[model samples]
Target: MESSFQSENENSFNIYLKDISKFKPLKREEEHDLIIHVKKGDKAAMKKLIEANLRFVVSVASNYRNQGMPLADLVNEGNIGLIRSAKRFDETKNFKFISYAVWWIRQAILQAMSEQSRIMKLPLNRVSTIHNVGKVVSKLEQKLKRFPTCDEIAKHLKIDEGDVREAFAIGSGHSSLDSPFSNEDDGSLLDLIENEQAPSPDDKIDGYFLGNEIEDLLNTLKRREAEVLRLYYGIDCERSHTLEEIAAKYNLTRERIRQIKERAIKRLKHPSRNTSLRKFHQG
Candidate 1:
């Protein structure tokens, strides 16, 4: 699946490269002359230098493919990095241009992650797996006194090593909620999402009263089930908790914890349990 995604990225990038094919690759002698002119504050030389090295920027950007940003954005960030490199490049560095510029490209990619990845989201299943694998990895780290290998992690999780490796790859990247899953895909995850309207003032007041009675409603469930919902929803636990943490606390698999939580929620939806809460709703 991941391989297919990467193939599409490469294909799309090829299409992009073809559009700017006139920017021929720079020869060493040609680069030297361009650098001489660039040192004299020649914008034409600078433009040529930037255009000539875009392929290198794309290659560098591909390294950050799974690092959160889309490949297109990664390339865009790398191009910015390349421009910065061009402006500050020392003619007498006695090194290849790409070797110097790679660091700047990576720095730009990391900076973009810091600025934008927060608002991005991945699918819930991927999120759950990432968290589950992370928890397992942490435990193994402590037990082994070193980072565990994929095989070691697989054994501990009773899953395939490839699955463990894939989880690691996913944990290192963030997919934008609006990004397409593949090049051929027509729409992004946003197509399925609707903007949530904030609660009305009257609704908020009713919710306040409902919160007071929620404890009584929850008490109808089994002790553990009720408490799991409380902890999961952060009713009184300060913040909503991840399944990984909740699983650890209960000494159960994360999947088991999720099942328990889901069952509890399903029970809550029954008309028998939410009768009092329903009265607060107008529509």
Candidate 2:
């Protein structure tokens, strides 16, 4: 049953790719007509646009198939992106459909990969750099039939070597041991890493709640006290809790709260910040 299902999936992908490849590239007049049809609520035109772009989607998705994802799954995700681009395409954007669609395609693929990959989420800035690095590395690998050196990739992407290595490291987390780098049978690369050591659920929860408690404790002070310590550590500089947030909690005017907190702080001892009671005020 599994084999039959796999064969059917493969056959469908091949047929789709063949049909998509046969589409004549749209000329300017043709594109204008399609855009008019789409804007006039023509579903057929929009469907045709998505159909015509499936091959391009596959081409882009192929670059990411090296990330140890199923090729058919990646292509499916990319097709969804193609559909999105078709719907969102604006004729006045002064950009070709291919250029605009590429961003959507990349976003869809990254979102899927991030969800399934080992490292979980990549921050927005890092996702773009990592995708670019993946493209460069795949192209280089195709040309040389081996992984490219960090220096070669850095040169190709016009990024620093350090960033190139870091991006590669993050992207590589997507692959299982069945990927190009492995020759082992005991377990996957991810397995080996997990075997070494990892924090337990209790430890992770404890660390999370401990940080939250510290934040709450910091907020318990007057606004000035919180701001002073937070800024001293680069914490709450942006719209940091106003004096009103603390004052309301203490049932006093902001000025009164500030005065009382000033006195309390002078008498308080904070070992972490190296602040002491004896330094500034008499009890």
Candidate 3:
């Protein structure tokens, strides 16, 4: 008898498995190339740009780039932005984190300027209001897919329009991270960023339902191969057994066990066999 998927998570898990099934197994040579690319410093590009920006405004990097702020002060303010960007970056978004973070880094620099010049400080309460306003803007930006106007933000925060305008006045316009919230004991706006990683109730319930379909696929392999994989990969075992341990248990040489492990891996990599187990890997 055929069984139907009982819940939405089951269906979602199935789709994720299909995506896994489409993965092409990497060859040893291809793996080396990937390592070489990463080693060649593609990942350091963002860090380099951040360093370059620090030497300029020393506070923020924007149209007002040559404010001649002290290098020590500039690095401090710029790094605050860098840390904030890492905290708030949404990996699933289509754009790069740096593009979204440009304003964050720049805003921190601007605040450094305001502090250095001893500009008029907003009252603590007003600073709190600005922080509240910034939170709404960040939320609404994601929801609306564009920067929300002051009126839109005001409505969302249920605060007055004048208050929103005051927050914007601190910068040439696009400033948010400059708000003076006493987030940590050090008094940074850094604490205002929200954490978005909690899984939903449905995801928790769905997590419990994974694994059955994968077990069914493993059942199709030769008994020895399937059992070996179950132990080697820790599919249903206490923990993954090393190839040598598995060899001793099976009364086989370590080299033979390794060959079996590799061959089984290649077999699982085949699109037809892999697609069968995609449902198992979904969780």
List, in order, the clash count of every candidate structure: 0, 0, 3
Q: Which RMSD does model 1 reach against the true structure?
A: 22.3
- Candidate 2 lDDT over 102-170, as tens digits, reads 656665676577546634566777878888887887689668754566688899988898787566445
Candidate 2 to truth, TM: 0.41
How many angstroms is residue 46 displaced in model 3 relative to the true structure, after the best TM-score fit?
7.4
Better by lDDT, candidate 3 or 1? 1
Position 126, candidate 1: lDDT: 62
Clashing pairs in 2: none
Tens-place lDDT per residue, model 1, 121-155, is: 66666666666777887688668744466678788
Task: Give candidate 2's error at residue 209 in angstroms.
Answer: 46
Q: Candidate 1 at residue 213, lDDT? A: 44
Q: By lDDT, who's the top model here?
A: 1
TM-score of 3: 0.32
